[model samples]
Target: MQFVKERQDAPAGFFEVEAAGLRWLAVPGGVPAVQPLDVSPTRIVLPRLTLARPTPEAAEQFGRRLAITHAAGAEYFGQPPAGWTDDGYIGNARLPHPRQPIESWAAFYAKYRLEPYVREAYDAGVFDDSARQLFDRVCGRLADDAPEPPSRLHGDLWSGNVLWTVDGAHLIDPAAHGGHRETDLAMLSLFGLPHLDRVLAAYDEVLPLADGWEGRVGLHQLHPLLVHVVLFGGSYVGRAVGVAARYG
Candidate 1:
């Protein structure tokens, strides 16, 4: 495949490369700023790396570092030239139409982040009336006073997204945005991968979670669960309904 690289002066040695119809770039130093870019036609291929279960201490330390990085807030890298979707769903609602400003995290999540997915699921019959009602309740609660300030987010984070390289652990395949830091941590917890205690301990060391974080886990998870409900049907419907129940 033909690959073109555009150079940038960032510390990580960033570059924008195009192959096929998709556009992706590499951040030279180990850490991946966003999920490895996977345009459409050309796919991103990386070397094989070993991933072992991190020790409690190592996991905690790594988790702390991730928290610090997430706290770095968002970047306005100009407007996207086009729109795309994941699997079959749109990447995110188009920005700057009626409500795309980054005024507050809660508003962003409510409109652009969670609501779109919720509406999709509702339209697809993935969510029953009760489930939809509960979801609205949780969103309202979160909107009241979100736990943390808007921080840069790795939209879709899971164990698979964390690459353990020779240099250190790196995050890849990010659906990057500016939202809550806990959203990432909540994702780590939701999937049951990545050592839980260690990850939280590490995050606390760097940026301690606010009180009542435990209660908000359901709120943060609703978005992902809704996505799953849309993508995987019955399997996620129960889980999504359960989470919605918490706020209702």
Candidate 2:
């Protein structure tokens, strides 16, 4: 790998929060994260990784590593990284993170993740009028969701973020925060990942997922889907509505 520098002009803490998340997530001894060579308010330097084809062996290792990463836990469900104090970002979008303390995971997720972005999507013409009511029903019944401690989430765990190299699977471009571990796994399953079954298998062997986890897949998926509908504006809106209807 060679040294690569990325430069962008933006608000002060954009890259800072990103670097903070990288440092925070990397602390738990598990998955390989991109080595943050150097960081600044407006720029970051990292080892530019060479991509390789994914294999089950590496996928299983990555799954086990990911479990260890999540097991490190976090202070609270909606907690941001130590230095970054705001809701983080996914792609170019602003993600609302929690500053106010909420007791249960369901309350934090409902208040911050589901309702806010759904409102944004609806306001942006992505969702139809009745969509909010369906989400309201889901939010109302979050207590029915399986209980678990906050998992250190790589908030944007889509396939594009997971890179396979000769060394191992490395996670990149994280919107790192404290949220439900199921949310991270849900994002992994959202877009197809190579050798993903191997990954899930290794994950299950390490830290067993909660009961009824499969049943709640769509529920955990609601946040990212809602984000995409807001960002992309098409069939995703319909899919988001469909997921909300399940809980409704």
Candidate 3:
């Protein structure tokens, strides 16, 4: 059996871009990604997966596999997945994909990830001057860290996008791109994941994260929160500000 996801009013290449992301994230021996059996302008067809209760064992394996996926690396920050030539989407919002690879993750993130949505949120009345200031502070501070090559990110790794099945956790609905690996891990923690500690521990065992990574969780989380503010204005405004305040 298969499942079909359709959006009659989807933007041009919407489902196609998602299909590309899934294909790009498919690494050898990595955590399984939901296979797109077919894709078109308006819809994507995927294999049906049986949902199961989460388990610590499955979570641990997923962590190790995820580490491998990240290790695949990318040409540079903000580079779109292979086979895609233009921008991507995140929950119906446009996600920028630079044709030219950027070696500096900080520059790419500030320009492509944070700033655009910040402007959107501000225009939508979900962001105030104070919030914008906080984000500006965070952006300035982002360069404090040592640089690392971009990881092949499952850009939206929140728990809801991680489908636990009888086989294990299978990734779905990716905003995949070249980004900081911590962003994915932070996103996993954003909305809570089953056996999250085990997941982190196993991932660390395979590929240790940078020191002070725990402290930067809020930094990586800020983008998604801002996107929330843009897409759903309300408590998300306060939530984004709260996280930005920690780093700013």
TM-score of 3: 0.97
Clashes in predicted model 1: 6
| Candidate 3 backbone clash number | 0
Model 1: worst 10 consecutive residues (lDDT sum): 12-21
Candidate 1: segments with Cα more than 4 A from true spot? 1-40, 75-99, 144-147, 165-167
lDDT of 3: 0.90
lDDT ranking from best candidate downward: 3, 2, 1
Per-prediction backbone clash count: 6, 1, 0
Candidate 2 lDDT (Cα, 0 to 1): 0.84
lDDT of 2 by residue, 1-248 (tens): 65544556656567777777888888566887786777886677778888888988999999999999999889998889777887678776777787866698999889888998888987877777798778888999888357888888888899999989987899888888998898888899999899888999999999998888998889889989988888897888889888889888
User: Per-residue lDDT for 1-248 in model 1, tens only?
Assistant: 33232323221212112111122222232134433333323244433455555666667656767776656554321112123211111222222112234556666667665677777788987777777777787668656354455565555677676766444576654555456777878888888755678778767877788887888887788778777777777878998888778776
Give the candidate number with the greatest TM-score: 3
**Candidate 2 minimal-lDDT segment of 10 residues:** 1-10
TM-score of each: 0.73, 0.94, 0.97
Maximum-lDDT candidate = 3
